[model samples]
Target: MAGLAALGAFAQAAPMVTSLGPVRAAVFPRLTGLGRPGHVALTFDDGPDPASTPRFLDALDEAGVRATFFLLGRMVQRAPALARRISDAGHEVALHGWGHRAHIALTPAQTLRDLRQGRDEVASATGRAPYWYRPPYGVATAATFSACRKLGLRPVLWSAWGRDWTATATPESVFHTVARDLRGGGTILLHDSDCTSKPESWRSTLGALPLLLEHCAEQGWKAGPLREHGIADADAEIGS
Candidate 1:
């Protein structure tokens, strides 16, 4: 019975994984509208900080684009106002764990506890439970998926990452990595907060924002939240 249930769930979720290959999967609600042939979604994690988040929001405002923000529960508790600001600015706020810890290393119960607390904290600040949950560092396991299922959240991953967690990564490098790897249904990972030891990681992404937006525009692509797209099996006949 357990195996059958698992198979059913997998079938349901499998369609959410885009065939574009290895790009991160974004759970619904945090996801924006579906992109055309070459469109992509931009997502930022570990945010709601006073230092970098405001500037990031400012840049998004200037570019006239809305992106997904996977926020840490602890950060939301510390900066509820900033969390509110993100929502008010029309960006989707999703969960990125309670403390931004690794899920793969945690027991299933521990993972569930963290996810529950994280969802509650984010909902308290933003007035809605985030529909998406991104594991810190893209770490996932069976326990992680189970916890997500229990909480009614979906797992999202990225197709292209800027490696902005590193201090040595230049803004140009960030741009190059994203622009070169972008494809339809791709989710790009970045960070709004500098939790890393290096301040350059945050600065590099902030610096690259305008250029990245311009590149998207030049490619005739627009940026938005991840929830706008729906997942359905292309091979499954509707009336069959």
Candidate 2:
């Protein structure tokens, strides 16, 4: 059944443990970035890349849509103006770690340092502090949770993703891949940069944007940034 399949897909998407998928879906639904009914959160990661991010900005602007951009600290440093431009365009800017490495591979101290540096860079660049954090590769560890707590950040992961980082991805594929698991109140993950992906894969993501927006329109569900998605920190007592 369609409902059963969506449940299955959600379980696969929000794994608490890298090896255990269902537990997180069952236990931490809020952390999975499921927001208020009739709304879908649009989010992009690994960017502020000058090459492709601008294209996404242009597309989003033309569509009259806004999104959350989870920016890497190192990338922001390379293009602080572009990073600020994202915020200036009314997009929600969030942290995606200082580097592209997974938290599970780093020591506790390293993880904490990475988050602090990233949070600082994003705040400095955007002139607003980020309240949300999404670990690189969506992999979270004890240290990651600890760091988030210290930083006063709420950790969020996607309920659906485009898997558009592959070299072979096309616009239609990206749109459908996300559409498969997507529903109202779901957060959709995409990448605006190929800095950590197969080169130029972001072109596919850019092209997929209109289809996704139109699909949400047809479904009568509003699509916008996480801030507008109405995901409250009180939804769950994170790091408790």
Candidate 3:
């Protein structure tokens, strides 16, 4: 019976992982980046892997673009230099939590502690406090917002994702998935590391990025990190 209940809960929460629109509206609509026009924020999560991160960084450098990287604390502990390399490149370093576990699995207290630890790890590695966070799997439970509020982190959900966290994803499919819903002033989600997601998924994302940037260039769109997406410096204030 407990197993059945757990299954039911998961069944209910599964949809929010793919589409956070309705859930975000009730929790915090403004942070969702919906209906905003003219700039797109590129955000990468679950990374700092030596094998893959430098590839994406080189691609971004070649394209002359900077993105937001939501780093996992545990991974940073494993690869601090790679994390610093990300920050050193002028990309935004934000938190994706200490462990890349779903919010539904954590109590409010545990979530707060996770947020604090993740924030500290990034700051210690990058010498700057991360003011933004995107929860694992993009699902936010009741505890998430409270933890973010207390932690001084702003909760952000992507408006477009490449659906690249699968073994089958190709660069073409990833590009189309994001291009279908992408617009100016929206946040685009991709993975630079597969640390907490499907293995080798970062390859598809890396392959798709240049095409996406070129698409933006042709559209006269400005593509960059969150700071350029209009979340004010004041809104990005570091918290305790």
Candidate 4:
């Protein structure tokens, strides 16, 4: 029965992971932002690594940019100080999950528990309850939405990602990948931690940061954290 229930849960979640539309709308509250022209938002995931996170922070500080960080609960527990630093540095700290498991892999109860636990862990570290949540791998289901509403958090997804977790990714490739899809009011995804990602995957993202920012500058786009995106909960939703 347990296995059957898991399979049934996966069935409901599968559609949302691959395609956006009715399933996307039916499952979660709307995702706002990612529209307009020249107002790109930069977001990072799976982070707060002591070694890499601070480096990213330094880079963002030097660049005069602020970003949103979707942090894993376990990682936050492992590096609370680093998590605090992220919030202290004026970045948004959102919930990723307690573990890096995809929503489909968890039962509805488990998913909610993971979201709450992750939210609590981050809040403990940051002294602020996060108002945003992004599921692991950007996969969501009816349960994810339920959890979001119950926890009083909003859901967000990206419009473009660098694919920087691939071992062969380079700065040029990362920059080009994101640049091609980047538009006005786009949400750009990148990683700051190698914890759940491919080892050393953070390097390419780090290397591409300045270049990506430069491209945004040339295009006259302003990049900042998601809090400034000015999106409503009635907007379109994104799939994994």
Best by TM-score: 2
- Please state the error at residue 138 of candidate 2 in Å: 0.5
Clashes of 4: 3
lDDT against the true structure, per candidate, is 0.73, 0.85, 0.79, 0.80
True-vs-predicted CA distance for residue 218, candidate 1, Å: 1.2
lDDT of 4 by residue, 97-153 (tens): 899887777889999999999999999999989988888877766677778878988
Model 1 / residue 219 / CA error / Å: 1.1
Candidate 1 lDDT over 80-138, as tens digits, reads: 99999999899999999898666646778998999999999999999978987777766
Residue-level lDDT tens digits of model 2 in 1-240:
332234334434553342342355455667778888899999999999999999999999999999999999999999999999999999999999999887757888999999999999999998989988998877876677778878988788888888899978999999999998888898999999999999989989999999999999999889999999987663243543
What's the TM-score of each model vs. the native? 0.82, 0.90, 0.87, 0.87
Ranking by TM-score: 2, 4, 3, 1
Candidate 1 — number of clashing residue pairs? 15
Q: Lowest-lDDT window of 10 residues in candidate 1?
A: 231-240
What are the runs in model 1 whose C-alpha is more than 4 Å off? Answer: 1-38, 229-240
lDDT of 1 at 60: 93
Q: For candidate 3, what is the lDDT? A: 0.79
Which ten residues in a row are the worst by lDDT in model 3?
231-240
Identify the leading candidate in terms of lDDT.
2
